[model samples]
Each structure stands twice: as structure tokens, then as C-alpha cells.
Target: MNQAVPAPTVSPLRPTDTRSTAPTRMPWLSLAILAAMGFILVAAETMPAGLLPVIAADLQTSEGVVGQFISVWALGTVVVTIPALALTRGFRRKPLILTAILGLIVANSVTAMSGDVVTALVSRFFAGAFTGVVWGMLAAYGRRISPPARGGLALSIVSIGAPAGFALGTPLGATLGTAFDWRWAFIGLTLLAIIVFALIAFVVSDAPGQAASARLPLRRVFLLPGVAIVLAVILVWMLAHNTIYTYIAPYLRATGTGIGPDLLLLVYGLASIGGIGITAVLIDRVPRGLLHGSVALFVIAGTVLLLAHSSAPAVIAAAAVWGLTFGGASAQLQSALTLAGREHSDVANSFLPVAFNLAIFAAGILGAVLLQSADGLVLPIVMIALGAVAFTLTIVGRRTAFLPRR
Candidate 1:
């Protein structure tokens, strides 16, 4: 496939030397904090999902209208990701990262205080832009923060933020909203941002490419064969999944009810955590396998949700399937982008978040339309169609993927 070679176990930078003064375990600690940053940034973005209904009532808007928070945030990300990554090139890593984290604090605070639809849209739009850039930063950061050999593993760890953020954000927002108000959820996110900011200030170290010597054209970034394929799969995956996921609360409210909404999200988040853990371990060992299972899981989850409208157990089961698949899939796909883009990993990394959020933006629009038009049946139909494309891509991608020869 003529892509970047698969990552080795040791770093690609300096060859592993045991006599160095830096603690061997130090990178792990730094990467973990980076993972936490990934967690909170994502949490801030998806927090709107858990509190969707509450925000609607408080603003006197329909749930679909309130759902624009997710849509606009993603759109903002799509708009700013490339430009932000391009502009930030050649800047030092820690300060740029700290700035991105600081932006989150401000964005979450903006969303927290918004009471009108217009205000919410503007606030969420900026918040989403911050998320997109951070995600781009996170991709390149993951590879350089640790040894190059463990780059895939490093990215796997970074990917933990997606599902973990959802696992924590959805339930945390729901619980906070249930106890205090939806505003409290964003307030809590702001507080976490402060903590993460401190952690980044102290823990994360400088890396290579934090201040790159040169820049590449954006079009030349994803010129590789598998790069576009990975982007397509990510777009299809998120579009299919979020089509239903963004509406989980309302879907439950409409069809049947036995479990509390917060509790339901908690269960789903836990499953997402489980999925993240599994994928992290497998990403290095069996990445394509993990990707295939993840896309397939989406199809299964959508089907389950469609048929299980009457059963609480059925819905819970669907949530579990959805979470586990999404968690693993998100990380594995990021790894795929890194591998496929090869020498252009940084460019690939920057663009990956853009693709994800762009897909989210697309899905947000698709979901709102489906919710209004098809009453949310768009999930199953979209899943099957997207899954087929993803699965087909998986097959073609395997033949041309960045894997070493068998």
C-alpha cells in the first residue's frame, strides 16, 4: 500500500537507552495526563447530549431545536480544524496544549451561562471550534509525547478520551442536571478544565514537531490511498452511530420508560469504558480486527434499538453494544489514520479530528432531520448502509492497509 510502516514497540526518536536520566515510566504519566485532557475536551462537547431535554425545556424550544448544540459545535470544529492546526504548526507543544485547554474552560463557561437559543448556538459554535483544534493537537501530540515505537499504543491511549468522555460526560451531565441544573454540568467541566490545565503545565514535556521546521500543503496531507479510506470510514461510522446516539434520551422518552435517563446513560458510559479498555489492548495487537468488529457493532446496535422499543432490557443491551463498539472503534480508527498517513502522521493527525467532528456535524444534521421526518428510524437504515460501506472499505483497506505483510 506504500504507507508509513507499522509502529515499533520502542520510540522512533532516540533509540532506547537505559542510562538516560529521564525516568522510564515518565512518558506513561505524561501520556495519561494527555489522555485525561482528551477525556475532558470530549466531555465538554458531548455534555450537551446528556442534557438535551433539560436544555430544551429551559430555553422553551423543541428537543430537536435544542439538539442544534451538538450540530453547531461539530460544524464549528469542521470549520476551524485545518486552519488551527496549520496556524499552530511550529509552535511549542505544552503552551499550545495549555492554550487549547484554557479555551475549553472559556467555552464551557460560555455554554453554561447561555439561556437563549441564539446565545447557546453562538457559545456552542465556539466551543466546538476549540474541540476541533484540540483534537487535531491531540493526534500529533500522541505520537510525539511518547517514544515513536509506541506511537500506535500512544494513540490508542489518547483515543480513550472519546468513549471515556462519553462514558463520564453523559452520565455526569445527566446526574448534575438532575440534581442541580444543566448549567451545573458545564460549570463542572470548567472546573475540570482548570485541573487539567494545571496537570498539563506540570506534567507534559516538549516533543519533536511541537515546533516543526516547515509546513506541508493541506491537499498533499491525505494524498495517500488509505488516508482517504480511513476518513471515509470515520465519517460513515460517526454519521451512522450519532444518528441514533444523539437522540437516546428523547428516544427513550418517546417509546417506553422504566429506567431513569441518567441511570441509562451511566450504564452506556460504563460499557463505553469497557470498550475503550478492550480496544486499547487490541489496537496494537489486532487493529483491523478491532475496526471490523466496531463497525459491525454499530449495525447490530442500531438494529437492536429498532426492534427493542418495548423492552428496557432490550434498550440497555443496545446501549451496551453501542458503547463498547464506539469506544474501541474510535481509538482503532485514529491508529489507522496514523499508520495510513505514515510520514505525514502529524498532518493526518490534525485532519483526523476534523473528519470526526465533520462527521458529527453531518450526523447532527442527519439526526435532526430524521428525528423530525422519520421519528428516528434513520438509525437502522443508515447503519446498514454505512456499515456496508465501512465493511467493504475494511476489506479493501485490509488489502492496501498499513499492516506488515503476513
Candidate 2:
């Protein structure tokens, strides 16, 4: 029997801080704040998706056209993430994060007040660009502050905020949209952003030695074969998940399942939270290969939903499984990517979010086209195709000598 050797642990403090009487470090609070920032930024981005119909009615445009707003946001994020991460390589974390929060505030405010569809789309674009910066900075910050042995767990905690945002934001936005207007959803997000911004500004410190490195080695970071494989895995998974998620409520309604939008949103949000919670505990203990294998369960869940269209209980169970696997697999992939780019974790982390948003953009376009075709089976088929791609990638990744050994 081969016993697993744990990764070496680092104290979450500077070496020069040699005060023998110093209190034990508390990194978890800082991690929580970083996670909260992620949650708010993601919520701000995804809130619109749940309120798409309301926004379309308000703007007097078709829902299809309104959906383009999400695409625009993802496109903007992909375009900006690499450059932003590279350029800000040596900047202090506090200012980098603060600037992102400011941009988010402005973006949310603009989106909330938009009088027309074009303006709303532009606001979402700016929001995405700012969100990219935040995502990169937060990941770097999490790595810097965490005890080395627990890096995976720490990063997973911060990453969990994104799915948590999805879980909460969609339901919150739908509920608010139904009560007042979709604009209020943006307003609520703006307030959440403000709160997180203030908390982070007060609690989080500038990452040590960040300013010591003057230039980011972008070329070297991208040169790793594992980086590309990890990115491909992330992209395929997101594409698969979003193709079904973007229309989950609609699909539920179409199947004559009496589930309301509010209840569906609740299920998604709670299931995602459950997934993240489970992963937070299991990631450090589970073998990386087994963790990767578990993502296939999401594919299975999506297929089950497609096949059992007449069973409401089965559909709901599948939804929970889908949410759990999607959320868990995301954290696993991020951890794998960070390990693959250990020398340039920030840049590597930047790619994960960029790839994620780009996949969302692609999925939206492809899902929209599929929905227009009126083929009830197309979405699930696309999901299974994506799942197959993910599984193949996982197998190929396992064969690669570049990945960290179990």
C-alpha cells in the first residue's frame, strides 16, 4: 500500500516576523473575504440570466437578442483577462482588488440604470472585463495567503464562491424581478459588491513580494502542455453545463413538470452549495484521479434528465447531481491548473476564469441556435457530447507525465 505524503505546509506569515509570543494565524477569515468578493462579482454577472425574460419585455426585444448580453459579457472577459493578469503582475493586491471593486460598482450601477438594451449590454461588457481582473487577483491572493499544504482546499473555498453566486444570484434575481423589476436585481448586486469591497479593503493585506517581480512571463506560462489540457477540460465542462443550465427552467416548464421558476432556482442554488461543501471537505483526501472521474457523474445526471422527462422526481434529483458535480469538478480543475502552473499560478489562474467565460459565451450561442431549431433533444445531446470530450480529456490528462503524481 502506497501512503500519500502530504504537501509541505507553510505558516501564513512572513519569515521575518519572529515574535515568539505572536498569536496563531487566522487565514480562514481572509479566505472568506476573498470568497465573498468572488461571490459578489459572479452574482453580478449571472443575475441577468435569471431575469432575461423580464429584461427583454422591458427593453421590447426578443429573449434571444437579450441573451446576447451574456455572450457579450463573456467575450469581454476573455479578451481582457490575460492582458490584465500579465500587466498587473507586480502590482500590490490591495489596489488591484480595490480597482476591480470600483469597476464592478460602476458596471452594476450602469446596468441597473440602463434605459435600453444596447446600454445594458455595454454595461455587462464592462462588468465582465472588471470581473476578469477580480478573478485573477483573488486567486493569486488566495495562493499567497494560504498555508502551502492546504492550497487546494483554500483555493477551492474561494472558487466555491462562484457557484455559490450562481446558486444564490439566479434565485434572488428571479424573485426580485418578479416582485419589482429586473433592474432591482442589479441594484442588489451593486450593494453586495460595495459591501464586499469595503470588507476586503479593510481586512486583506497586499501580497508580500508582489512588487518584486516586474514582468510577467506570459509565454513561459502558456508553454506548458498541461496548461492547455487543463484549460480544454475547463472549457468543455463549462460548455456542457451551461448548455443545459441556461435553459433549465424553460426545459422544466416545457416538460409539463409543475416546478416554478422560484423553486427551480432554489434547487439549483442549494444543490450548488451542497456540492461546494462536499468538495471542500473531500478535495484534500480524495485522489485527484478519482475526483476527476466523479465529474462524469454530471454527464450521467444530464442524460438521466433527458431520458426521464416524464418523472419530476428524477428530474429534480438529476438537477441536484448536475449542480454538485459541476461545482465540485470546477474546484478540482482549478486546483489541477494551479499545480500545473505552480511557477506562474496567477497567470494560470487567470486562464481558468477566461476559459470559463469563453465557454459560457460559446454555449450560449450554440444553445440558442439549438433552441431555435425546436429540437427538444438537441440540448441534452450537446451536453453528452461535451461530457464525452471532458472524459477523453481527463483520460489524456492522466496519461500525461506533466501532471503532479498521486
Candidate 3:
């Protein structure tokens, strides 16, 4: 049985009552800030992907070596997420959050100024840890402020930031690097981090709940009847999606698809954000049905890609559908996890980022291996197979302990 954790305790945001401690009754501003933080950090994480050549040139390293350095960011987050959260469990939420944002600022600034690869990798490692801590806390932070009945909606609102960051960040890094230098991209991250910091300082609640106080034992947390199944659903779904997504560019290039891959990516990103919009409207009203409908999009998209991978328009349409489903599905799963964990939502929430990042890493490696061994045709089939299986599991398990107790 899950033990209940108290909803967030409201604390004074400021030492003095000079300004509003939060966004005040509306909380929309605060929500936007959280969303922007998501966007900024995703962008920061992806900057290397966009500006690799420029970074390699300035640092006098091979592009291949620079590409390999992505491990510094990935590995850093993977290692630090749990430990950082565990160590900082007792701090005030708002300031710790800002400090996390500050950590990003320092990371990016150090990266921008690094004269050698060692300095840059160290900076990125710090950035990853900072971003990981924030991500670990993000869902709790979002849910804590939400009116219980509208928790899903609030989560969806904040969740929109990831796709938005990808949609904007991929291009922003290239634009800044091409116009000035790669360092400008890091500078951009720093600037955005500062702005997000200001928003957190001014708008987010001075909530007093330290993270670890309510966290349940990880093993026991998953031992709740439906939690593991739902996590399986999430893992397969994420792995399936990332498998195709990580390799879309190469697939398009090889196939000579009539559409521009970059354009399709932007569309995919926008559609993902659109999916979040769909969730915002429907999650609280018909939560289970909404999840079923969203998962079905994956099945449909996978089938389309399987049958018509060569049709540029079909591929494009499939990508949009993919984004829509993925964008919405993430928040929906978070909702489901919250319910599945019963009163121990904090423990459940912490599992999300860890699962998501692992899926990305594992699936990307697996997908790349497949691409090298087989062909583009095989990737979507794997996606379809995984998606179909996940759909079946979710549908069959809908009425199980996975859902919210009404």
C-alpha cells in the first residue's frame, strides 16, 4: 500500500513580503516559466547536435570526437539525477530550483569560454547534472501547484516545453552558430537560463516541501500492482518512438524523400506541441479514453510508415501523428503514474525522467545498430511491433490499478 504524502506546503518566496510569492491565483505565468525552463534545457542539451562542426573547429578537435563527447552530457545526467535529488531533498523548492537554473548558466558560460575539450566537457557534465536535478523535481513541482482535479492539465501545460524547445532549439543553435560562432549558442543558453531564472524568482511559489521527505522506497514504489506495467508501457512506447525519430534524417537522405527532413522535423515538433494542446483540453474530462486515443495514434503512424515509407507526404503525415501522440502520451503517462503510485506520487514522478532518458539512450543505440545491420525499412517495423504491443497492454490494463481512483 502506498503511503500518503502531503501536498506541497506554501512557503514565503521572499525573506520579506515585498513581492507576490507566486504568480497569484492565476498561476499561468508560473506555468509558462516552468514550460520555458523545459524548453531552454532541452535546447541546451541538444546544442551540441546542431553546432558540432563549429565547436570542433574552435576547440581544435575532430567533429567525430566532438560528437562522441555527447556522452559527457548524457552520462552526467544519468549518474547524477538520483544522487542530486537525494542530497538536496531538504532545501526550499523555489530557490533550489533557481540555483539549478543558475547551474545551467554557469555550465553554458564555462562551455562557451572553454579553450580546450576538457574544459568544455567538464562544463557540459555540470550542465547535465543541473538539468537532471531539475527534471527529477519538475513533475512534483508542476503537480504540487495544481488543483488536484486539474493536475493532468497543469502537467500537460508544463510538458509542452520539451517539444517547443526542440522545435525552436534545433534551429536556434544553427542560426546563432552560422551567424556568429558556436559559442553564441552557449551564450544563448545562458541568456535563456537567466530569463527563466528571473521568472522562477518572481513567479514560482516559495513552496517548502523538500524532495526526499515523501519519497518512497524505489523498489516498493514499483511493486505497486500496476506501476511496473505502466512503466513497461512507457518504456516500450518511448523506445519505439525514439528509434525512428533519432534516424529520420538519415532515412530521408538515403531514400531521397521529396520533403526536406528539417522541415518535417519542425512540423513534427509543432505537431507534438499540438498534441499537448489536445491533452490540456481532454485529460481531466476523459482521462482513460484520452490515453487510449493517443496511443492509437502510434499504431496508426507506425502502420503508415510501415506501408508507405517512400511516400514523402505519407511520411510527413505520419511524423505529425507521431508527434501528436508522443507529446500528449507523456503527460498522460505521468497522470497514470501519479494515480498508480496512489499517495506516493513524488516517488512515481521521480521515475519519469530516468525512464525517459534511458529509453532515449537505449533505443537510439539499438536503432542505430539496426540501421547499420539492416535497412531503413526495418526501423518502422520495430516501432510498429513495439507500439502495437504497448497499445494492447494499455488497453487490456485500462481498468486495472493503473488509473486514478475516482
For residues 28-86, could you state the per-residue lDDT of candidate 2 as single tens digits?
87889898888886777666667666888899996666777778788878988888876
Candidates ranked by TM-score: 1, 2, 3
Off by over 4 Å in 1: 1-25, 208-214, 402-406
The residue-by-residue lDDT of candidate 3 on 36-77, one tens digit each, is 998887777765655555677888985445543454665567
Per-residue alpha-carbon lDDT of candidate 1 for residues 317-403, written as tens digits (9 for 90 to 100): 888887788767766777777777777777887777787788777776777778777654455667667777777777777865535
**lDDT (C-alpha) at residue 185 in model 1:** 86
RMSD of each: 8.1, 8.9, 7.0
The Cα error of candidate 3 at residue 221, in Å, is: 2.4
Spell out the clash pairs found in candidate 1. 10-149, 11-148, 11-149, 12-148
Clashing residue pairs for model 3: none
What TM-score should be assigned to candidate 2?
0.87
> Model 2, 181: alpha-carbon shift in Å?
2.1
